[model samples]
Target: MKKISIKIVYKTLLVSTLLTTFSCKKVFDVKPQDQVDITNNYRNVYDANAAVIGIYGQFQTLADRYIILNELRADLMSPTANADQYLRQLNEHAETTDNPWADPRPFYKIILNCNDAMANFDKMVADGRMTSSDYQQRYSDVGAIRSWLYLQLGIQFGSVPYVTDPLTSIDDLKDASKFPKISFDQLLTNLIAFMGDGKRYLDVYSTSVSTTGATNTSLNTTVDGYATNLFFINKRCLLGDLYLWHGDYKLASAQYHYVCELGSLSTNGSWLYDQYLVQNGDGNNHVDIYYGNSTDERTLVDNNNGGWRAIFGGGVGTLTGQEWIWSIPFDKNFLPQDPFVNLFSNTGGSYLLTTSQLALDNWNSQTQQNGLPYDARKLISVRTINGQPVIMKQLYYNVDATSFLPTSVLQKQGRWLLYRGATNMLHFAEAACNDATLGTSGVKLAYALTNVGVTRVYDNTWPAASSLPTDRTNIEQTFLDAPYNLDGRNGETPYYRGLWYRQVGSRTRAYLQPLPAALASDKLGMETAIIDEDGLELAFEGQRWGDLMRVALRRKDPAFLADKVYNKLLRDGNGNAAAVRTKLMNTANWYMPFKL
Candidate 1:
């Protein structure tokens, strides 16, 4: 099924007038609200489940705005010629209160929905319609969602109103100071506490699907019966992420290690990783796990257009269970338009570009093998259409190449990935690097973590379909077969290699994308190794800006941010790089100012 068709019992409700009022003033003034009948909705577990689905639905509504706010503020993408004035302002870091994209209403709306779900779910438990354990699980789930929303709001908007209660009447809004705005640090503190609650009730394990009768090829090929478990937030992933944001390296590493180790286990009880290979006509190879593999049952024309692909191109249960930890699913029936396609697809109109040297240099690495000297992620990550590169990883359905118009099939809907194994692996590596107690083990873990993603690139060509290359020496030799290898990094045995040999055409600082020569004098000589790895492993996935923020904040150096973004703009050849840099260097420009 392209969408999870659980018939939601409660209607999708938004306190639209309240949201508007909240956005317009520091103190919310509301008229007496009319009492609406709502008691019937929480009478049973089934209805409570429907309320949970509605929470997920609220996330769906925030998806496009999420990507826009996160990505545009970073340097990974450029405003297209078709970009509206508001987009141009955002891309240039000149956004003010008037920019619609900077509005905090969306985040508040999701938080409001979470508030309602929590209140109603509590009632369900009190009424004995839901078990206590189930109630705890539901609370944990909703809390994680709410915490994440606040974290993002804190990231984009420096401080935001922290409202936890559902406003049913004007009385709830009367206390202006009750909704005190909190800082990002405070927000992280609250988020960590919320995810701690999640850890107590949520299981790290996902339920593998067993029943299967659908004729759709993808559904038939599912590794498990159903993968509904991957849709909601997992405690380990959320905890790890929240801890990382809080700079609690040891705790973050622990959480990330749990997710990475768990991700290695198969839901269907097979190999450690969900691995697949697709051989191109030229005998070149690409990993299906990276670009996403579609079986005969799960193609653009089919009903089963989901799995991890749902995080990008919409479809929920596409893959049974592999790398994707959590995602938001969208269907055209519900959203009316696929925002990803609307923004990046050819048939749709937009002018975002990834043609910068930073993007191209990484694309040229030998390890990212879509083809020799061209990482497989190149074409998939950013497609060069009409001699310009635009983001393409999320576009995976029926679209005319020339026209770039996506069909209205539910398959064309894109998903939003909250967390994945690759990102977690890198997170563990970085967190371990920051942790002193791990000692030598931390170094090895860091090396292994880097290899985990790099290996996926070259592992595609090992030429053995019957077995995974378990031999460390054999894996090293296969990678060494390439045109270039950093000879000194290869230790005595394949298992001991801590430094990977550099590939041809790759810069020394390529892995940890160094600042351009213009900013080299700034002496932030520090390559953001983990952030670089994240770019290669999860580009255009909407984490680039967050990665930048993590580094800048961790070191207490706005120089890192000023250098990376400003230097890119200075070299952008747009003739206005200086003007953009002026706006971006303000530090205040780094975050969206809150209105109301």
Candidate 2:
């Protein structure tokens, strides 16, 4: 049993407290706490609110490490010449204990904050300092944050000390007898049970408090008057992820389905299905692609045109709100400044990471529905800056529109996207494809979701439907029923369209052709397509390695993940491709060394 020293706990608490004190002043409107007296802090609702904000402040520190560890270890990202030895080691899957990102202390610091807050929140409710409603909402919020951090720990470290009670010192974690380390699978079970069925958690902040000028100002309001859903975690999405890792396909599908339904309700149907796609000149729905004139022929669309890049660029408005489920905002004015500007920007940034050549090849291999030779998303995702290809999604705000290049002046503020619409739909499709109860219908539904979307008119008579008997041709009707139906289709005299009618599917939205008809019966092939689509849509947003790792672990196929990373390195002309592949073929080698 190795004694891991989490010396950052007190330091993180002090830093996060100071950071949240100023950052949350505009929104929560609470006074700064110069000192965090954990025993005496739960005096009122304001204190509870500040505590939760502090947790987020600490969690925000993990943004850079999260993206770097998740993306670099997997495909789609390569270290640049300017990248330090640590970055190169991470990319090569040969990280040593000296790598700062390998330390688990930062993650536990946030978890410790969560545990302390939840304990005090319960006491606040019991002492009549806060209402039970407020306690439940805030407690569950912190609990979800803890669960998410543990999940990341499990993903990156293989096994971790599962601590729930607030600790007096980090040294207690060193004693294996007192706090036993648990495997990733056991961690999932605990998280799934802790998060529950998602009914107990509050969907949004509903507390009303009296402000100086206004009476009963709802805390559900946006941050700094911006319509952003960046402050809290989505309970259902976290539970869905837990179940997905736990191998509970039906439960995972249900959780993801709830998120989709919530998205529909929250955005008034605009966020549903492929409604985000625009109707192009071809009379078909497609992701808004910006093709410049013949002389400067390249994709250069913006948020105004509903381009795919809008998902990452603009303020948290309609375009971003529809896609980004949960995000962590980092501003230059805040204590923890935006980290991406330094990692991704070439003009004013260190330019440590870039899009791998394999990702470019993956995007270039696709033919769009318009008969274009390459995927339009690549144009929006990666742009050549200073003769080097940089991930442009998060750096859009710091780039010049006319030249579509990084600007010399950088505004160090960005959002770390956690969960979103496309991810929800993809997870649902993946779960449905695996659930035996759904059968071949699940495969068709999954394919349709990633391709052209499910519709009774088009999909009912789809050639793939033949795989199911006449009686079960409409077997997907089960999903069409209440609670599960994402498609707005139902039996009525004058039929009104559901969410699926507007759904053009992820691939179709990217202007890519639908998968082959034969894949409808091939579950493995369908899963591969879904994972590939994940790489295309969610690249560099920090979910790549997890997606690949989850699928590989599920199928017990290390080669599935190994081959991809090997191909990425090989394409980049890295000599370590074979060695990396050989190492990754062993499941134990997938995770980093668990050190404090």
Candidate 3:
């Protein structure tokens, strides 16, 4: 199947922007009913296609804010000279209502677009202009996208007003009390419901127009052109993520396992990819995940060439990696341009920067000092320039290895890969570990070793599969004694009989990063191990803060939340460690308060 390129057009008509930052002065210029040409605009399949593309366009605009707020607020990133006041404030955990990135407007705007597209297409179907299957496909696509946006909102802000219908009038905002604030748990429930409907309407296997019996014969003929596009959001992937967040471990595992199962199939359809996305030196590492081993116009890198950097911005021109299940598309010459490439790349105008010791020390400890071989992630994720650590995760433009590129070139190539294969695999591991009823120490350890120990460990010197102990006490003790084992990148010697990530680093430095509060005192070593692995595997991907929040909230450990940030402050000493620790220790500080 051929991949579709997302070309953004900025001729969208805003339905209602009253009392919001994105609201235009012309909000009243267009009539409530005639806000957009819904009746006339969606008359043809081409027009309907334009509307769907516009929905993805909204995601492009959201790329910068999504990354900035999620990452800058975490311990992994701190502000540099390029940072503005708003950026600095966010790093300091002092968010204001006026902070543009913190505002929920972008999320709501995308939801409104989804609502508009779905409603107009429904009318078209009712009028016999569109087919029933076509309507189902479009409805499914829009619902899943909306649910994805809602999940982000719920994660950032605890209780937000759940708006299902489009707001057509200023009166809708007049009565704030009418809008009910949905809790994070309740929001996940609603999102699950949305995923259910989306899955029912979407096809597991892509079909041609003749096979689908669709009225839009021109576009729906191939799996690539179908309205229920596999590239936008995979229903099972979305469902699995939702299940994981909802604490339904068995259900989450089932969904992720299904994805993994499909990857192993020889004749799998468009819904699942067949190869691993990123790999280490040896092909044995991170095996059996989804990816594209071949190269075409859609993707620039092939099996022999690409790894993490290639999958992201290994100087590849296209965002067509098979591992990318869902992503916000970018056009270098469009209204909503990409920002990450420049933000991380531009040494001339750097906005976000790497913390001095957190990443560098981590790289040294694991790659050089540790008995295991060097991890490839360190080379791809961070590099030291003029004795300062800088992030190199998503630099799209070309640059010399030691120096930062100019921002102008960086902005021209900003692209964001939202979801990938490794993300799904790790989620599966986490779900298994956290599963209350179905989880056991052996099961969790097995899942962890499969994803991290065997697949991601660089030296491939992880303990033999037969050596891992089945008992929980033995596993805990094995980790506590990991630092003493000195087998370096060689499987010849019998070593620690437990998970590969048993001893991440010395106790003093590693504790600066948060430990999962849910872990027992005996299993606390695993907390630092998980945090280290997550940092290395998913670094510069906008997940650090949320990961900390999840563990902190679940364990209710103030020290866990305070330690990482406080340690950073003590190193820099710009802010008072006691004040910052006090603020973060408070559970409320974990999330940005709802500010519409």
Candidate No. with top TM-score: 2
Q: What lDDT score is found at residue 486 in candidate 2?
A: 53
lDDT of 3 at 531: 60
lDDT of 2 at 410: 46
Measured on C-alpha atoms, candidate 2 has an lDDT of: 0.72
Candidate 1 lDDT over 421-465, as tens digits, reads 566666766665555565543443344344433332234342233
| Model 1 stretches astray by more than 4 angstroms | 1-36, 169-176, 197-199, 204-227, 263-265, 274-321, 349-357, 365-374, 386-388, 398-411, 439-444, 452-527, 579-586
What TM-score goes with each of the models?
Answer: 0.71, 0.87, 0.73
Q: lDDT for model 1, please.
A: 0.53
What lDDT score is found at residue 312 in candidate 2?
71
Tens digit of per-residue lDDT, candidate 3, span 512-558: 22223233222334544556666666666777777777767667786
Off by over 4 Å in 3: 1-35, 169-174, 197-199, 202-207, 210-231, 265-304, 314-322, 347-352, 367-374, 385-388, 397-411, 441-528
The window of 10 residues in a row where model 1 has the poorest summed lDDT is: 277-286
What lDDT would each prediction earn against the true structure? 0.53, 0.72, 0.53
